[model samples]
Target: FKLSLLQIAEVQTQTYLEWKEVHPPQLPKDAVPVFDKKSKQTLYVARLEDCTPCFYDSAKKSCSVSTFHGEFNLGHTVQNRKISFLLNKDNFEIFEWKKSSFGEVPPLPVETCNGYFIARNDFGLGYITDNSLITIGAKKQDTTENEVLTLNHDIKGQHLTITEYQIGSAKASENIAELKHFTASNKNCEAAKQQVKLDQGIDKTVSFLKTRTHTFGGTGETSVSGKVPLIISIGGKLGLKYDYSRLNSKTTSTVEKSLHSVSMEVQVPANHACSIVINSNTFTADVPFTGQLTRVYNNGEARRTLTDGIYSHQEVAEIQALVNPCTPLVDKKRC
Candidate 1:
């Protein structure tokens, strides 16, 4: 019931494990360096492992991460429950059907609607697109364009929202942190380094995972009212061990899940206008010379649901985040 059909959660463990065996992920060759306003002198990430320099710090025989605040869902919108997920397991199946469906189904190729819109990615769990800017769940029930959301926000629910946010706020460094000694790990390419706790808040996440047993609601009836971890891991494998329990109850049960993700960054070339268009809106900003942005995931859980033939049960787990970058390095060329 965990990864149910409607869940549409990305199942990349097997695929990533296979890919890692062939060419295990490397720390990003270069970390977009930054100038730390608090320190005056630029705080550059100078760590690496497995012959690759991490986006944060993986070399210098140590692991370091930069922490920042970012979120996925604003806790104000509701995601639509997809009926298509019930019939397909992965995107490949969906793609196969679309390729031969004779135009009956719209083929979702990264961008759609002649570039008018794109899929909404919620970390790596799932994504969606709608005809409206406010999305389906944000509108009042009586509105003319009101549409249905998931079971959590159908007609029965009231004043509900899907809130995914870190409890703090931060300004991204005006400059990117440089990746020094990129080739330093080459000579000692025996094993990857382990995680180091500097400013990164990994200990906080681990503490929450172990001590907290009651499942908190993530979307409806949930708010960011507790201490949240600002640091996260990326471009690395996460050995996620979560507890599955009934909502608002003390009873629990479950196992561990390992997720593999490639580190990713998006940067705008200098002197060229860079902008991103989403739906009907456009965003323009002044990015520094080191304009690379490393993707980050939250360090909390979700209120994902499970169902038997007769009833559905609600559960919660952590999510993805951005920045305060810290990641683990394992053997077999993993970092």
Candidate 2:
């Protein structure tokens, strides 16, 4: 009986993350304001911790996402199954939510709050594989509705997320490792799960927005992916990866960012459900959504210079679409 969504993503990526598995297009129309174009994709990631790709299970929550692997479903319900955070932030109090503790969730506290760090604890968004500096967002749901989730990461990694569904807090204890104390209701969602756990020391990749699931009955099927870790270019090594040995100084201490695009709008209120899948596009849920999805990977215009370093390239770069995501955002914008 309550669903409010406002997704704003402005990621202008230039480049990383090449682990692929895409397939999400089931539209009967519950919500769709998609804007697609600028197609030229090429991905190929071979190793992300011995190939785990993406898979999550926090007592079986569902909100969809695939990258590196595991945990992040703040929506689903038949009876016992729920999880959520984020209580306020009407525009940069920094987008509210950050009060502390439920089972420990942390990542992104300060990196300018642009956000980009996706892996660890399998629920902490730790590594953020780096797909040419990616940022993708689009959220809309309905299984009835009642969802709430929020994420913000920084340690200089940049990862801000929000998926508002409902239920804000309370109820999600059917063995989520035994609910470390998340039953008392909202404390800024326990401070947004403790800032998603200290902003990534990173363990396995798990952390999200939407909670309610015992077995994805709400259908927000997720395996959370977008690994993309396979970039090698050397010639003098001032560190590694992309360096004709530095012809003009961009430094390179693991430089990745620039080419951003993120737009997330998730809301649930009624029954409850959640789901979010990027790099593979999938936001299908029965219900459970809060709202918030901010992805900003900035390193500055696709950092890769080789004026003469002998040159080398080729892995993935094939997608010449006119506009696809369903392509709808016309008239005033043209998609």
Candidate 3:
């Protein structure tokens, strides 16, 4: 006899509730219950059954059924079910078979089931019931030391992967003999040699500045004598010389002088030679050497004097014009 819509729904509901009592819904711990729109209630699938006889395989002891029912006026209808039992075992596990169809199946009463249910239809789309357990052959306890098993589900691809891992007790050691041989075969690369040269330059610069002396020479009847100690500041600037003197043989009198100087900053890198402002008058030729004074101003002088080869006469005039008496040199608008 054909069942009415109301009668069919009632039977489905009754069957669902009965099966739900035996196997409570085993949803994901994070799963929130979804309410059915028609029933205005949250429902879980307890069990699924096929009314028609299923295809059976005696050798495999499995049965499967694929059924299609419904009217075009009512809607599309496709139903598939399969079940397998391990009869030999006392508490035999049951497996549900799913078959795909050309058209969509009518909405079943249960959307989810607590136990394992695997459904595959004619369509590539398939679903695996949550927390399903599948066991083949006899089960045995894992006794191997540090053995681990991992299961991962590919929700998009609808597949499951199982991996096993085990830890080994063997110890690992470096090959000291091979390492020594490899180290002996290696020589200092070009870059390493350059770095060593730079280090030597820096050391030499420090020593040179510490012992540096300045001497003045002129063909005039005056002898410029008396040592001027060269001072190198931490920032690599040449500090001012104080109380410098030029001795004259004719008068036997010494002219005292003090001067302010500006020099360029130099930097050395491991990959390249030292870099310095070569265009500046304070250019120093020695590696790691403090630059020579590009410009010098004698004490009480209004304008500084540029050393030869550093600044042209026009450049010097421009620099002098940029210096304003009313404002600090750094704040001058033209600077």
Candidate 4:
């Protein structure tokens, strides 16, 4: 069965309420404590004022409020399935009752008590008028009056307790390697200055659309992996050409490994548009390739817009290039 949004919300609400029943949440208490090893110390004293929540940071070993609300000896004693608070009787049944003969009936009033003591921890037993030392049961369900905990007896005291405490770990340091530059164009400007090897007998025409700043070392390759419409300019007329690499295995295999090296003759257009023509296949459609390029212009006054569209992860693998540092001259107006 399908559940509505409201039904999903109710399921979450019921789960939270069920969890809160036995597992009383840790109240924020910032009570600073003064421990005395030589003498007995009253860890906490609860009253009407102690009803307010407290904030404590155990890692810092510091607290904000002045009173510990019975957390020291009875922190983990509370569970989730035992909430037993009473509803306020005065606010109960605020809705009216309507009768067929008399229209509306008068509300009934009577003295009522609704507050109930909860047994999640030993808070109810420790509320004494006289200032006296009290201890809670360790495992056995015993509620005696004003019991004093002792190390000599096999009570909760002197038992090894596993607690979560905070410890100072680390701080970050400056990186040693330099950062690379990014650009709008598909190619790096400075990288155009480096030489690319063309297979001895192959005649290749390569072009770049945009220039980016990058580091000095890396390998480069190109390949086509999809079906797209190919057009050619013949006799000053644009003509449509069909690329059948998808249907024929021999044609697709040969085109996939064909080498068309990048050259300096081809410049990236001002708006970062780039297109290359290989013998029979036209490369206006998107193809994924990883290569290296260097920073072209680092002049302070030089500014150009990038024109490459970011592709989806399923469309292509991210290209990695070894990038070098390209620091431009500082400008008095802006750097």
Instruction: Compose the digit string of candidate 1's lDDT tens values, residues 1-335.
Output: 01110101110111000001112222332222333222232222221122211112223322222211242222221122111101111111101111111112133332211322211111111112233222111221111221111111111111111123221322121112221111112113343332211121111111111111112222212111122112122111122223222121111122234432222232322222222211111111111111111111132222222111101111112222223322222332322
- The sequence of per-residue lDDT tens digits that candidate 2 reaches over residues 1-335 is 11111111112221111122222211111111111121122111111223322222222322223322123333222122221211122221121133223222243221111232222221221223222111122122112111111232221222222223223321221111110111111212111111111111211112222221111111111121222212211111111122111111111112222232233333322222222222211111121223332223232211111110111111211111111122111222211
- What value does the lDDT take at residue 238 in candidate 1? 20
Where does model 3 exceed 4 Å of error? Answer: 1-34, 49-102, 105-164, 168-335
Model 4, 1-335: lDDT tens per residue? 11000000000000000011112323223222222221233232111222321122234322222223444434222222222221212221111111111111112211011211111123322221123222232322233332221111111111011121111221112112211223323233332323222231222221222112211111112122222211122111133322222111111112222333323233342323233321211112222222221211212221112122111011111112332333332231221
Over 4 Å off in model 2, which ranges?
A: 1-43, 46-163, 168-290, 295-335
- Model 2 scores a C-alpha lDDT of 0.20
Worst 10 residues of 2 by lDDT: 1-10
Model 4 residue 183 CA deviation in Å: 15
lDDT of 3 by residue, 1-335 (tens): 01000000000001101121112213322121222232233322222343221223333333323222331111112234333121111111111232223222222211333422323222211123222211111121122111111111111111001121111211112111110000001121232211111110101110101111111111112111222222222111243232222232211123222232223222222223322211111212111211121111122212111111110000000000011112122222221
Instruction: Count clashing residue pairs per candidate.
Output: 29, 111, 6, 28
Candidate 1 lowest-lDDT run of ten = 10-19
- Report the C-alpha displacement of residue 246, candidate 3, in angstroms: 80
Which candidate's TM-score is highest? Answer: 2
Ranked by lDDT, the better of candidates 2 and 3 is 2
TM-score: the better of candidates 1 and 2: 2
The candidate with the higher TM-score, 1 or 4, is: 1
Better of 2 and 3 by TM-score: 2
